[model samples]
Target: MEFHLEHPLSHSSLHNDDADDNTLPLPLFLVEFQHMPSSHYFLTLKSSASLLSNRNFAISSITQYSRKFDDPSLTYLAVNYLDRFLSSEDMPQQQSKHWVLKLISLSCVSLSAKMRKPETSVCDLQVEGEMFDAQTIERMENVVLGALKWRMRSVTPFSFFSFFISLFDLKEEDPSLLKHSLRSQATDLTFNLQHDIKFLEYKPSVIAGAALLFNSSELCPLQFQCFSNRICQCTYVNKEELMECYKAIQERDAIGVEENEGSSETAVNVLDHQFSSCGESEKSITITAASSPKRRKTSTRRC
Candidate 1:
């Protein structure tokens, strides 16, 4: 889906469950992410225990497997499924063979594609020289779903993007167009940063905020100061913490986007970020950055 800055964002698509104008608080989200099914699911090389080397192998295999599909989102989603599944379950052989992990990677990509957008035609078992029969792939998918508790709608950094972006007074022709640009940049950074465990420390909302901040610095330098000031005024976001997260994100990308206390000179407004079941009391936190047209190579940590 193209993220148009000017495109109108529905609460359902942007928020988790058609959340109202008063979005959920960041603290609540942090707490939920900590315990929710997803909180346990991350794919850091070190987090793999003895599977460190094998984790790298899986990354390589999945990267190759991703090429078989036309949509990149399928790969990203499949990676999420793979990481989550690995978090709670073990390989059938438990590191007895390399092909086992490769099979898992294949199953993940295929299952992700099927879950996200199932095709009417039977899936092709062969990608390259390797082949996974339908039964084996289905068995793996069942294991993955069980591990994830069938929670396919994984809450991601993208979930909090709309609330954070709403804080910015980005009035333009079809704000959807601009929103898309910002969302696209943020999505790219999120995908690259997934391999690192450092990001897992922060809530997805905070990470989303940081991504928007970096995108703002890169794409909307002219309004960077204004955006920074407005975002800091948010009660839910500690200015220091958000800035710290933003710095980490930039360093990880190695793109070197600088942050300045620029101008709180811009008028700050309190946003009632009322998320689902978190109560309507939490109010007034804004975090959003405008989009940029330029693209830069992200220094992703391989392996």
Candidate 2:
């Protein structure tokens, strides 16, 4: 993870003196990372076929359905709901049921749409045309609400974009333009990479770092070393983990190959064995959205 910096940053460069209102301050950003799924959750996603299939279905459904709307945040936020719901100790029984999975996916998009546009109702966001009534969708929404413990606001990688961009020492005259370009490129990667299950192993912060580092190599090859060194020096970053995620993204980008899970055994005892609680309380964080090629347009809303 180490990089040779021809011109090393001074101690002051590592500290954020001015805070951007759109981005979380450093202290709050660190607190938000605590709410991400625990490492055990990733293990369960690997071990259980039912869980993996449900996740795949939910993500795919959300991706397909979310295309009609022009909001990028909806897909990511809906997937976030799906992940948190699946990660909870009390998931709905019959994980293999198609109707139940559709209900879950529908309810998630409905909820995200409501958060972004209060005028939009559950009935309006129904996917694949009226699969379930509004009342049934609302009930499932309640189930999702309970599973997430009423924590609708999510802390995603977007929350860290501005904060991380600030860490770089941009010598360009229009630093804001460079920052916007970097953020846009990184945003594209974060949205597209969500389909890959392996990324679940990394935290949003680590994912953001990897995406930024990956893009920096192309956008500013000359300053890549300096940017990497500054990011490594950040107190909140785990250098090893960042490098691991970075390499994984690089490999995926190089091959342009998307990984798909193979057929597996039944879903027996998966909920009882894998979806149990972590036996500890979790915290919370806020989120926002962005526009990109693979993403829909979105208004500001907590993910």
Candidate 3:
């Protein structure tokens, strides 16, 4: 999807007219900066256990709600908004108020649907006996827009999938089929890995490259090195960073594999050992989506 700045302005009136009228159009440079990864300040923010747990709950809530719409793009973008909002602003002591959490999830998903032009009804999303009125959701949408600086065009790993896939040299008669399958596999990996906070530390492009490389290792082991070399040689990709992300993904997938085989005890041991050896900065890494609990019911009163 091409992200022309004018497309967003044409579709949604969520940005306040007065505020927008007062400000000049965003410059190309500033717009490009939005696509970059999280800043060091956000990565180093001192988050308490409660804050991380609350964030995990909100992320899981958004994940569950978006799936109801049966749109992968919607789910991806909603979670992207949630993470970016949390990174930009600090939310302290928000765990106790479940309403605020539900509101955040709804607003993010609503905004994502608007941006993607998905056939989603806000009323239909009022799940688990919780109903938020359009006006209340609109208000929260404004909050999210302000926090995100009206930059709804999120640059996720999906953005680089095509570019990386183009680098592959498929010798088969039906390369398009191979490419589609490979892309699909990589896309699912990227989506599932988002729940792991450690993946957030890497840029979208790096994550995209790593995901592609990981998928290629399975689908085309013989050409894995070729794919890796091409990806690493790209000017936008940092070799060391990609390697770190790849390692983290491998470790996360390992735990999933162990758990699926009915070795819950071994999975716990692997998680503990990995966290114990990593530095203080890496301790924020949490469980992958494979072992995450089922999405709890959302219970917000009508707003």
Candidate 4:
């Protein structure tokens, strides 16, 4: 990757004439970048002492490398680990940004596989990234964990899935499948939108709890009641705001239904011409109460 360096180092920006000032002065390198155009400025300053040549690549690579992991929780872990490692005194000064990023990505996958699927070994991860070797990955994992002080467990996607499940009425077995589908949808949705959906923005723990409650038919009512009580206690969002979101979702669903109906009619017309002699055999689809939509009021328990 080619990097353009237009501005040379200047001493005037570095000197603090105020000798009386007790605070340590800002670095000259930072001041130089501050004067440069936004488009020209790089995130990671290329220090002659450091092994990393391209700082821009370092910042950009982190984002690109993270997508390979595909799991949000794992990506979050990698990001946190990278940030913590960079801030720590023990971080290898000689290591390139590319190496650091690669190491963190490897560590995240290793940790995730261990936690989520214990049966999967380190070799599995190596195979996924054809170019990367297992030994390099293992070494990086140790370094990352040491830098993080081994405090890895934190917010996760499963927790969020569980919380959302609690808000709806679903079976125990239903939740597992629902969680899988929701996670898959969330992955695709995030990629296309590059933003988190409002409905999926709750804390992972809350979401996991909610998912459990939603999945169990026996527990859903109680869970919803508890959620309602908690919402009343919390001042973050009022009842009006909640109702507005619900209304918006309903309108969107209605529009989708109209589109589907038009498509169905078109399909039926195409089939009619193909099988004209058997037209009478085509049964009229009657939507009964079992198939028809039923209006259910959003229940809110008083605090």
Report lDDT (CA) for all predictions: 0.57, 0.66, 0.65, 0.38
Per residue, candidate 4 scores C-alpha lDDT tens digits across 237-297 of 3343333233323333345643532121111122222222324443322111222132222
Cα displacement (angstroms), candidate 3, residue 201, comes to 0.7
lDDT of 2 by residue, 173-257 (tens): 9988878889899988888777676677677778888899889989988787788887778777777667657766765776555
Per-model TM-score, in order, reads 0.64, 0.74, 0.71, 0.35
TM-score order of candidates, best first? 2, 3, 1, 4
List candidate 4 segments past 4 Å from native.
1-96, 127-135, 164-303
Best by TM-score: 2
On a 0 to 1 TM-score scale, where does candidate 2 land against the true structure?
Answer: 0.74
What does the lDDT read for residue 219 in candidate 3? 85
Lowest lDDT block of 10, candidate 3: 294-303
User: Which residue pairs collide, candidate 3?
Assistant: none
Q: Please identify which of the two predictions, 1 or 4, would achieve the higher TM-score against the true structure.
A: 1
Please give the range of 10 consecutive residues that has the lowest summed lDDT in model 4. 1-10
Total clashes, candidate 1?
27
Task: Name the lDDT value of residue 228 in candidate 3.
Answer: 80
